[model samples]
Target chain A: MSTTSPSRWKTVRSETGRALTALVIALAVALVVILLTSADPGAAFQTLLTAPLSSNRTMGLWIDDVAKLTLTGLAFSLVFQARQFSMGVQGQVYMGGLFAALIAMSPIGATPLAIPVAMLAAMCAGAVYGFIPGYAKARFGASEIVSSLMLNYIAILVVNYLIRAHLAPAGTGQLMTAKFPDTAIFPAILPGTRFDLGIVIALVSALAVWFLLYRTSWGLKLRLVGHNPKFAEYAGIRSSFIMVSAMTVAGAFGGLLGSVFVQGRAFGNLAQNFDGNLAFEGILIAIVARSRPLAVPIVALAYGYLRQGAQLMGIRTDVPTEMISVVQAIIILLVASSFSLPGKKLFARLRGQKSANAATPEAAK
Target chain B: MIELLLTVFSATFFVTVVRTTTPLLFAALGGLISDLSGALNVALEGMMLIAALTAVIVSVYAPWYVAVLSGVAAGAMLGALMAFFHLRLKADIILVGFAVNILATGGTVFALSRATGGDKGTSINLPSKAVPGVDLSFLEAIPAVGPTLKSLLSGHSILSWLGVFMVFAVWYFLFRTPYGLWLRGVGEYPAAPEAAGIPVAKVRAWSLVASGALAGIGGAQLAMFNYIGFTRDMTAGRGFIALGAVLLGARHPVGAMLAALLFGIFEALAIVMPNLFNWIPGEMIQTIPFVVTVLALILFSYRAQRARQMRTLSKI
Candidate 1:
């Protein structure tokens, strides 16, 4: 009991130390970017640090960012946990949103039932999109990274073509779909914000993901396959089926992310470059969250805050919001790195000590 | 249909093919080098984007060659950074590459806005320099195919000539040289080379640098000569297409060049296809190259599988 408690303390200490180092590096990079680029670093820093909460409108925008980021983060985390790194989530998001928009604008979608139908269409589109890569990986032994990336461009093109050909109004200028009907519109929960129910949906999703992953046996099977597919196969588990299902589930969520983003706004329609790289950002969020389903909401919030605050800094100061991406990149490098910074060797030593206690069973033998 | 076919076979179309192929060829060579060194430089897109912007901004103040060199240097430095992070710091190569990619996406735009005084979309405002093309008008004085050859070969950006020569150079370096052998050995089976006293990490590090420098040249050619200036993400998906070329070309240098030429043909077709088929949306026409890339990759995999099956059948 005594040894277990000490080792648990060691685990927490090491984790915190690593996260702190990454956080420090990220902040330092952000600081340098400000000082080097901005004419008024002080004001930029203040706005960047506080602007997400500065006003009700900005808060609404921040919430909107969180809602979308959280969904994508969850989508990425699910496949990541299964050790099937699928970059197809964003493609699914693209397909999902395109389909949702298509359905929302259809004749049958004019009724009150349109919104749910649209959402379901998005889920199915995204899931089917995801299933392609998963099935290829499972059956053909293809590289998901490469295939998903290729599919992303395909999805972008397909959606672009569809929008340009059919849904786009016979107009003079821009190629975009007709505005979604009121049936597909979300009612704003907060009085002042433009976006609504998205945050609530995202929060509910986070809770559902937590429950599904931590409290369910299917989650156990998925984790087992992710950790060691050969071992899972040896135990009679169908790893290929699990991989396909996991990817399909991820696609559904990713699709839902796009729908939430589009429907929450008054102009609920698909644009040319509709992806906005939320899928890639979701990958970043998952990495930062250490691929934890439950930790996603909080991390997504923090990311959303940085992004929203950076937007404010762009408007209020000379700095560009792109600076947040620099910070985000540095954080990924530092967090993903196995090399503890010079002083952080102490924590690694602590980790080694904790592992040594686990060796006691062999020592007993 | 005849006119469309004529358009496809015209000398102008071949020139377009050469122009488009040059950047993809350079990037394909870069991807090939890193791939053969056991490090898939997935950051090729990011590296090219940063290098394109760097060259475009530098050209506003410096000579074309100097700007191109600066772009190469920037890419090499990034390669070194990737090596430092992935090798020394023990990070996953793909993730580190992705991080570099994400950095490139935002960093180039930020730097571009700063350089061009807040024009985030395009570098139309920069007083950028272009690489001069070599003249081959003398070839026209010769016999029958001379005029055709002159039309195909003359007026290509000087970098396009370098791109052609690099095919032989990279092939020689990879197949006919000892260092190339070491790089390949490191990629295929590192333990054997390590046992033979070769420094695997150093070879990998140099390969990454070489890869970056090649991609940098591709970026330079695209910005300085392909279009005479940079636009936001002007490299587009050339980097990824280069990866596809690496495989579709059978991971050989000559194959890569040929595959790049193949993709270039499609891009050229896209450019000319719009004029012939006005009914088809231009946006749909633009998708041809990307669609071809996905199809080519799938075909490549299928062919490889069939070949493997035949080999095993014969062995049995």
Candidate 2:
């Protein structure tokens, strides 16, 4: 046990070191892009690095971005861990937001139970929306990526149709629902900022997912299926059931994000394309976090900081904020790439030690 | 309903379907080639988008055919980059595909702003040339079916005709040649081909390049002929739809063309419905192609599963 602990610590240290290296390299790539595009590259680069910390407002936005990305990141991590590439989170967010807004505007929203009730409804909506692609993959052998993408377009259109046809107040020019009642709104946790109970919800949700993925038999079964589906099936595990459940639970997280967006001060009403590309951004966060439930929030925080800074840079300089996406793509490619670095021998030795431990009977599962 | 039927039967609607199907057909063919090579090119969306913008920007300075060729080159280069990352560096193909998409989305907007001197939403300010439509008004000189043939076939983009020829060409290349068999063998079971002394990795890499080039032609058709200018996200999920078309076409070249045409018909309906049915929201109309793609894919999967089960039962 003592020997295993040291090796595990070494592995974690090496992983962190690699991640840091990747981040620095990604930033350098971003610097090159900025230099090529921006007339005043120095200001743009500085703004991209420091703008998120310059003001309370930016800080609030950054925190909100973190909270949102964390939830979506967890959502992506769950399905990805199950080895199911479900890109339906964007659609689930739209459905979740729609249901949450509907519940919030209903007469029941006047009660103190409104937020919980609305949130529950939103989660259920998201789960059902997620179930379509999950069922398609498990039952029909359909590709979840393509099916989920189709569902995303349909979900967006459905949400827009609903907002335009039924949810929006009559005579309003915009495609948006009426604002939620004050009782339904999540109160700001910080004074003069948009931070609210959603942040707490996000953190709690992250911890919950960690416990769910690490501390439960269900998680063990899910991970077992992910590691080897044929082996899991040989061991009497229903791989299909786990895949669906993973997606359904991940969908619940997407729904929670939707509810948070609509119920919080960030958007008190549902609108067409309100989620923007937030759900898609989660995929990057999930990959960056290495699909670890516990690591999602930290990665989200780091990414959210950069994203907020990029927005500020876009506003302040000629360098487009889109430059950050170029950096992001480069980072994802570099980090996800399996290259032999100088420490490769040491890393392989540590992994060999871990594999030797895995030869134990209990570890063989 | 009668008016809708009349519109559907008319030559103009047929023209719209052909025009719409041309881009999807190109992308779908690209997707089919890669899928046959065992590498699912999810970057078709990003490739098409970037190519569309490249075509638009390049057409402003060059001949339309050269502009189209530039789009193809841009897509082929992206394919090579992806091959470098996925094959050499061992990056996951899907993640790398999404990375390309992210790059395309953000990169295109950044480039557009620079090109148009600040218009990030579109390349409207750019004086891009269009692919010349094939004039077949001479068909009217014939006797009976003259006007009908002219209306049916005339004025379509020259690339649209190329799209039809490419379908047959891809079919012949994928099935009729020894290289085609090798490509299929590589995709189906690389170990067998590797043992057989074939360059399996090279085959897959070249498949992706060809896939990207095909999708690039689709993008050129889109920006150069379909819309005449690049808008933000102008591919608008057509690349994805082409993926569905690849599957719905049963992974065959002909099947892909049919599936693309199927989606094309729905797209044409969506475009035409907004005018006829003022009662239905435009958003609902726009969803028809996506809805049909999902339904068709589900049905295709179901049938395929049944076929597999039946074959196993027969063996028993």
lDDT of 1: 0.83
lDDT of 2 by residue, A130-205 (tens): 8888999899988888889999999899999998888889887678988889999998888778778888899999
Q: For candidate 1, what TM-score does chain B get against the true chain B?
A: 0.98
DockQ for candidate 2, C-alpha atoms? 0.63
Quality class of the docking in candidate 2, CAPRI style: medium
Model 1 error, position A39 (Å): 1.2
Model 2 Cα shift for residue B196 (angstroms): 0.9
**Best-fitting candidate, scored by lDDT:** 2
Which candidate leads the pack in DockQ?
A: 2
**Poorest lDDT segment (10 consecutive residues) of candidate 1 chain A:** A356-365
Error of 2 at A244 (Å): 1.4
Each model's lDDT comes to: 0.83, 0.89
Q: Candidate 2, residue A183: CA error in Å?
A: 1.7
Span of ten consecutive residues with least summed lDDT in model 2 chain B? B83-92
TM-score of each: 0.93, 0.95
lDDT of 1 by residue, B1-316 (tens): 8988899889999898888889899999999999999998888888899989999899999999999999998888889988988888777677788888889988888888898888888899899999899999999998998999899889999999999899999999999999999999999999999999999999999999999999999999999988878787787788888888887787799999988999999988988898898988777787788778877777777777778889999999
